[model samples]
Target chain A: MSKQAGLPVLEQDEAVCCAPMVREPLGEEAAAELSRMFKALSDPIRLRLLSLIASHEGGEACVCDLIGPFDVSQPTISHHLKVLREAGLVGSERRGTWVYYWVLPEALAKLSALLEIPAVSAKAPA
Target chain B: MSKQAGLPVLEQDEAVCCAPMVREPLGEEAAAELSRMFKALSDPIRLRLLSLIASHEGGEACVCDLIGPFDVSQPTISHHLKVLREAGLVGSERRGTWVYYWVLPEALAKLSALLEIPAVSAKAPA
Candidate 1:
């Protein structure tokens, strides 16, 4: 696969973490694991929060940097960030007085792959 | 894009429907739309049901074909299918005494694209 400039090399294992949903039925354990991630993404605020942190400079942002854009309170943003972190979609680190958050590419990639509709499934019924 | 054998052509509009989450923060409307779809996927039973229908013969399956594998009652399975249908992730048709369900590739593709992490965001911090 062609790598994008300035991007970290994806882990080989995670590169193929999930089969396309159309290839076969998901096992119960896999469905449960994936559903937890989807549950975290089920809220609008959380979705935007994830997007903001991911698109921020250096592919990371500080908690302070995140709070200014939304109408919600700091605690609310923090609560949503905590949920994203718990879902393994983002990671955070404290630097002196502030916390920095970044997207976990592997997690996002796994979900993306899981939702891929196989080319075969795109066909109209014969 | 190369077309897949026996698959219906994807609409040009849908082929480019969603920008990657890492490209920019999602707008309120877009986030709300996507979160609704994600909410439908939050349940484990629904996730498996989507997968099973997508992978079944002719890229669709009848209600009778679906009920045998799960331990849940038929009404419960029917309820989950309704949720998936209402979310626009799957479509259904009634012929005689049974209903056949199929995954909507456009919907799945839209969501898959939304979760995609841009390559630039994959880089480790310097």
Candidate 2:
């Protein structure tokens, strides 16, 4: 139930309630759905393998404990964990020959409520 | 002064307090500085030119009122506003002929506190 935990703080204050990303432009279907989730967070080894599977412990982690902390090529860390499990931001299981991965804190809280910014709301108008 | 307004909510609750992006992977100089700011937010024409310079109206916007709402070209919207002002996430002045842009809402609140996820903290252990 994570998509920003079923949103509604006025839909996370209207995920920048249209017309902002520099004052008007994004609408080729919302820039192709926010650039396919920022191109699955445009790498950096998938944001440090999604911060090592959201800081492990039991949140979950395993692809052989995330391949000896990178030097690339375990098929490029299995292609950045298959692009962070196809951008839902991690959630794999497999078990028997290992696969783990967990952190889906509501797709990183819907990409932090789609990069929120009311910017201390009510100031830009004057 | 954006970079999440000079960070501090205990550094935005320790930006997920290290160790989690699927339990460890990000350090090639922190995935090349968070994948060069998520590859300058991996385009969609620079997220609709940073949401039309963060919803214009004084927060800022101009490049001739953002090239009449897209279809590209104007040097590809001035090369996606110079990749959102080199990923500082929008900010330009120039005024001479034109060039305005603004929305640096602390670099989108330091990328919403680096995609924050204390996820109601502590529970992963089991």
Candidate 3:
């Protein structure tokens, strides 16, 4: 399967190199690409799923392990996981009958860094 | 005017105190609240607008200054600024004929902190 089928293939490299949003204006194309990642994070279900996956034991969880805590159907949980994966927030691998998902630290770090308030501006009076 | 009309008053306190997503599973209510802020950030135009406002001189920009960089109309820029304000990412003030907008450092810090990977997990093998 094409990598883009499951993740933001075209922008992954850019994601690593892009400056924080506070440093300068995000170019039109960069904003479009980054917004897709943020859009996936805009759903409550997806946020909870990503949290669950990220906080899971050893920083990963199998689909079987992920589905039990939520009240939603298994398919619904799977769908949310898919969204997280496609947004590049999480990665998954099929191991026999179960797919294990793990948080993509670099992706999360990129976003975390983007939201960083510059030191000088952060210290400025509001 | 009610604070909720222009910003997420109900969730601002929660945003201030919530733990990083990598530290634990976010509760349903917290996830729902945060999703709204992330939803506001999901648009490309809004992101660019925010970046412009943040990096502008003195860490603030007037609506007049914000409108010139984009291809869209003035009203469109205003709409996006409203979204940013309501998400708590920014605060605005009416000064003369223009509304001045500035990044809310605390709000951005909250989100930056939320995405932070725990030190242990961040150091763990992928």
Candidate 4:
């Protein structure tokens, strides 16, 4: 979207562009794309599962390595991982007996970049 | 959560800690806290509204300035704004006839910090 909040809505070519949200109003299309990614992170189990995979050794974790810590059932964990994978936050591959998962740096970086409000952007609401 | 995926859960002293998710598995409490913030951002309209307010002149915007760009009813927009405020993503003030809103940089920074997966953390899923 235009920084000036102009009336005309334009197609944003880069949904994952580097500009922080503090830089401009997001285009409807870009917002939808990014919001899906956030929605995947909206659940506690999903968030924890993502962290577990990301922080695991080798920067990845097999489904076998993932099932131990959580109180939830294996199926439930798989569902959350599916949500993360569907949202493009993580990528997974089926390797014979088990599936491996890892956080996609580009996807996480986009969300990180979008949320980083500079100190100068901090102003009182009033 | 412990980096080793130990069975015992510990109290995370800092929910808004600076360490990225890639650094370690997130504690349950921190995941719940952060998931609420992400849930608030899950909606595309809410995401755009936060961006709009953050990018406004003086880093703030009045309700009057916020209603023009979207096709949604004023009440719908207000609902989204309320969600953002409640999630600690934005702060609001009512001065005279209109309410003003601005992004809370600290809250945004926490999310930014959490999601910043280092390039070194990247690995193929397989």
Deviation (Å) of A120 in candidate 3 = 4.4
lDDT of 4 by residue, B8-113 (tens): 2333345445578888789888899999999999999999999999889988899888889999999999999999999998888888998999888878888898
Off by over 4 Å in 2: A1-30, A37-39, A42-45, A50-62, A67-83, A88-95, A100-126, B1-27, B30-34, B42-45, B48-62, B65-67, B70-83, B86-97, B100-126
List TM-score per model, in order. Answer: 0.85, 0.32, 0.83, 0.85
Off by over 4 Å in 1: A1-17, A120-126, B1-17
- Where is the poorest 10-residue window by lDDT in model 1 chain A? A8-17
Superposition error at A122 for model 2 (Å) = 38
Q: Name the top DockQ candidate.
A: 1
lDDT of 3: 0.81
Ranking by DockQ: 1, 3, 4, 2
Instruction: Give lDDT tens digits, candidate 4, residues A1-126.
Output: 336645543323354545688988888888899899999999999998889888887778899888898999999999989999999999999889889998888889888988987655557432
Q: How many pairs of residues collide in each model? A: 2, 42, 0, 1
Candidate topping lDDT: 1
Give interface RMSD, every candidate, in order: 2.1, 10.5, 2.5, 2.8
Q: Which stretches of candidate 4 lie over 4 Å from their true place?
A: A1-16, A124-126, B1-16, B123-126
Give the alpha carbon lDDT tens digit for every residue of B41-91 in model 3.
899999889888888878888898988888999888888888989888898
